[model samples]
Target: MSKGLKGKLVLAISSRALFDLSESHQVYLTQGIEAYRQYQIEHEDEVLEPGEAFPLVKKLLSFNASLGRDRVEVVLVSRNSADTGLRVFNSIQHYELAISRAAFSGGRNPHPYLNAFGCDLFLSTHADDVRSALDAGFAAATILAGGTRRAQSNELRIAFDGDAVLFSDEAERVYQAGGIEAFQVLERESARSPLRGGPFKGFLEALNLLQREFPDDACPIRTALVTARSAPAHERVIRTLRDWDIRLDESLFLGGLDKSAFLEAFAADVFFDDQAGHCERARQVVATGHVPHGISNPLRDLPAD
Candidate 1:
């Protein structure tokens, strides 16, 4: 294990998540691994287009330039074998992204290497990999094929769902079993008590630490909490953030309203939610990551939305 990456914010992203490899992936799906390997070799010189997470990765890497040190690292974790992964490296080089580390598992599960890389976050198009990473206590999301609307401002705006993504799904469990009435009652009763941190808590804390490096007025990174909770239920979330000493640039308690327009209004680069329905709607306006976590995601073997 390399102790040098201890203090840095590290991200492990899949090749499919980092670059647009849908065409090549289709080759693999229709044909077999041998055909896919040949296709990649034939197109080794061609550059792969950016995927949903590419812009976010660029913004993340930009922090190093502002801080004048390698404070953030993005490592490529893919199922493609090294021989077939040459195109991915070529694409990274073409984009001039400062990502040199990689773990090509040759179609095996690569979540185990995330711990070795000391990854705080993991993004992948593969749902199973994301679920495995989350199961291993790392913040992970399945990157969806979302809209192409990138934030116009230089600021990198990231949005997250409250319940499974940031806080534990305890209240969500109530909502799932009982109804919204029961969930609201639970929130009102536990208003003062802070909610437990979820898988993304550590990732959020790391972002906060990075945000502190710059002046608050001029920080390039902005985060928002976009949830369905409203009014009385929101009290617990506020108190939980206070308890954790974490701050968000914006908070939206939509009260079960559609989140697509609000996310577009916020000009978010990416939004994360645990619900497939929310992810399906939000992705229409902004890049979305489906977080398969908490009680909501009981079917682990289901495909990504």
Candidate 2:
């Protein structure tokens, strides 16, 4: 089958994720929508600061020039009305981003349009929108606002957790119910069985397609698997990826070690993990996206609000 977006890796990012909107968001929360609208209009000439996902987006777009073709597409998906979204567009012009497409939903949820955009990934600051996209089986993450450091390197390094992000949460459910010992036992026994694909599997596959466009030694994109599994449990993950025919450049099996420092050493532009605690720690060093998926996410265990 022919790919959507002409075989480009399409990403739909919320305006708040592309540019910092803390001040404007505070205005809306404290004053009201009218004041917030006026504030955006007043500052329409001012270019907004880059948000958490800006660096990643920039790196993704750089592929077009390097590869001599349009290999990636980034679309703006914002909750702002067109009138109030002028500043965002102006900022894009100021930054010279190649993004020419957008969806201004006014105040409505924008996840419904993700399918129309053929988005492989959705990054947003709004948790509700992220959850909605994930529910619809799209690779989505809530961009964390806590990261202070950014990668300065040209290589785009992306790290992902194994269970629940790349592979299904079946192992995670066992861990949550039976602890690490049982989890290891299950993994040991299931070493020959291929794990089910998680939501991010498709996203990783899309990324792998792009990576293959360049020669192995010259590829600009680097991917890593930063997982907590180690030793006896590692065989299944290796077999699983082999089964899927996906190749990750680096794989770190930390075996319950804190992933922040290792992720820092990797100099990742962005890291995705289903565990909130891992994301929280990771954001202190690198841009982090909380997947909010699988058994690790507490919200999934709770009743819908």
Q: Output the number of the TM-score-best candidate.
A: 1
Tens digit of per-residue lDDT, candidate 1, span 1-305:
34337889998999999999999999999999999999999999999999989999999999999999999999999999999999999999999999999999999999999989999899999998898999989999999996666745568999999999999999999998999899989999999999999989999999999999999889999999999999889999999999999999999999999999999888999998999889889889899999999877887545543
Model 1 residue 173 distance off true place after TM-score fit, in angstroms: 0.7
**lDDT tens string, model 2, 154-227?**
79999999999999999999988999899999999999999999989999999999999999999999999999
How high is the lDDT of residue 42 in model 1? 99
Q: Local distance difference test, per candidate?
A: 0.91, 0.91
lDDT of 2: 0.91
Give the worst 10-residue stretch by lDDT in candidate 1. 296-305
For candidate 2, what is the total of clashing residue pairs?
A: 0
